[model samples]
Target: MKKILIFSASIGNGHNQTAKAMQESLGEQGYSSMIIDTLEYVSPTFHKILLESYMNLLRLSPKMWGKIYHNSERSRLIEINVLMLLANKLKKLINSVKPDAFIATHPFASCMLSVLKGRNNWSIPIYTIITDFTIHPSWINHHIDYYFIAHEQLKYLIDIYREDPEKFKAMGIPIMKKFREPLDKEKLRETFGLKNNQKCILLSGGGLGLGSMEKVLDGLNNIDLPLKTFVLTGKNQKLFRKVSKHTYRHEVVPLPFIDNVHEYLHVADLIVTKSGGLTTAEVLSKQVPMIVHNPLPGQEERNSHFLLNNGCAVHATVSEQLIYFIRELLYNPIKVDHMKQMAKRIAKPNAAEDIARFIMEDMASKAVSKVPLGGE
Candidate 1:
């Protein structure tokens, strides 16, 4: 079996989740793959400093992080320095892993691999899965072979490779196998202990739980609809404990970190979420309308923009807006259905499999081309 190495940094849940999804698909296609959290594994110090600092910025000064994110895109200094920091370590890791091909699910990893590929002239075939609706220039690197993007909408917008359309495959973001289809709603609801008669709302912030979950629930408390809100506080133990203990006007079910998030998503009538790219893709896969709440400045903000522009989701910057959007979607089944249809139009349920298949096919084609005229 061909060996594959996936580079995933645990900045947030998206990169690791995307990596696992791709790994699963690749494994099913008869490839051996291992995921490496290079930041944590290769350089634990950098992981805590950089990744923790990023989390703190998002939590404390999101607007500042936004400014830094956009401003840094205009300059390659940050990328260069980051590359320097990781290059030697990554080189050692690559030599150790000795994989046939490698994949990057995080921009940091992609950047490092791209620069190292050019610097060291090591061509083992590398690919990047841009796990967002919008493309940041940081993810761009000439040495990267193929770019798997969420859609064709921003293909031209990736300033560096506008001419190389062939390199950009709108294969969608790799979500897990379970998100391939929204399960039977009634049956799933019954299985999950949800009432059939009441409207259901699914609330989430990616795995880190960046959004103000308590405030969102407070806003929902004002709405008089017979609603059952299932709050998924992914990896947010504090939020889980708080929401689990708190009483609400509507039946509030606080969920711990779950592997089967897709199931609750399918059971939900309306979803209020902070738009991380992977979470957005998962919600879209479930064909549920979403209310994007105060997304953290950089990619999440852009992801929110894509969702709203695509007509599958509504945006909310404050509690009042959240309540309003929730009420609007609750009473408006026609609009909800329209949003679902729009989601269906864009969501690539088989994205993980498609990406894996694309990689293997490309590898096979290259192998065939390299064979001597009649000599294997």
Candidate 2:
């Protein structure tokens, strides 16, 4: 059994979830995989400060976040130094695991892997999975063996970032194998205690559950729609309780940290969510249309554009717009059908298998090259 190391951070839930999903994916394909949260391995104080500061900035001044994203592109020296420190720490972890290859789901992981390749002469192949549809300059690095992009348009974007075009493989987003299998909508609805025929709308604020869930739920109260609503307040106990206490006559379910996300996706006809890469990918895979709320500055904005252009989702800038968008989606069957069809066409059902196979083949070729021919 070949061992593989998957690295991610805790700043957001998507990164960690992606790492876990990839592990499961590899297992189904008959490969052994392990996940490590690099943040936990490091000093807790440093991780706490960094994560809190980032979330505070995202919540308070997103424009500043946007500027940082823009600056990351041009400030090569700064990025390189940060990468050096990250690489040194990750190098120790990699040496212990001695993984056949490294797979990174976060941009920082890619940056650090590049540094290891540059400064430490590390030769293990590293594959960076670009979780979002739009490519950022920070995600582009010279030493990565390959890039698994969300779509073909991003391949062109990477060209502008100066990466060789041949390195990109349009493998869609890596999701759990459970999502790839066809779901029984009626059975899923029953599992979640949802009505058989009534419309179900799933509202999620990504893994942090950072968005204004209560505010969005309150706004929905203003609209006179007859759909059942489900809000996934992930690891956000305060938001969960606040939303749960609300006395809405309509069927509203408030869940905290559910393991069966695909079941919820299967039952939802319309999903209102933040434009995180993982959320958008899952929604797309389930063929559920989306209404997006406030997205984070850089990658989230790029994801929003891709979904909008692809007819998989509609954007809502403010609370009112989100409410109105839900109303429209609930009432219009034709538009809903159109969005669902578009989503099905774009969903990559075999992404995990493709990625696993890619890694296995790369490892095999490398091993073969080291053989001594005509050994006595």
How far out, in Å, is residue 138 in model 1?
A: 0.5
lDDT of 2 by residue, 1-376 (tens): 7777887778677788778778887887677888767655645676788789888888778899888877776765244775566567766666666677778887777777777766655667788888877777767776898988888766667667666887889987788888878878887778777765577888885433434565666667765656678888777788778777877767778888888888888888888877888777877888989887878777798899998998989998877778888888888999999999988888776677788888777788878222111111
As for candidate 1, its clashing pairs are: none
Assess the local accuracy of residue 168 in candidate 2 as a C-alpha lDDT between 0 and 100.
Answer: 87
**TM-score quality measure for candidate 2:** 0.90
Query: Per-residue lDDT for 126 in model 2?
Result: 80
* TM-score versus the correct structure, for each prediction: 0.92, 0.90
Estimate the Cα RMSD of every predicted model relative to the unseen true structure. Answer: 3.9, 3.9
Q: Write the residue-wise lDDT of candidate 1 on 1-376 in tens digits.
A: 7888899989888999999999999999999999999678767987898888888888778899989978867875255766756756777666766777889998878888877777677757888999899888778787888989999788767655464677789999999998875468789888877775788888774433434666777777777777888877767788888877888888888887788888888778888888999989989898899888878888989999898889999988777777888889988889998999999999987999999999999888777221111110
Which window of 10 residues has the lowest lDDT sum in candidate 1? Answer: 367-376
Model 2: residue 130 alpha-carbon error in angstroms: 1.0
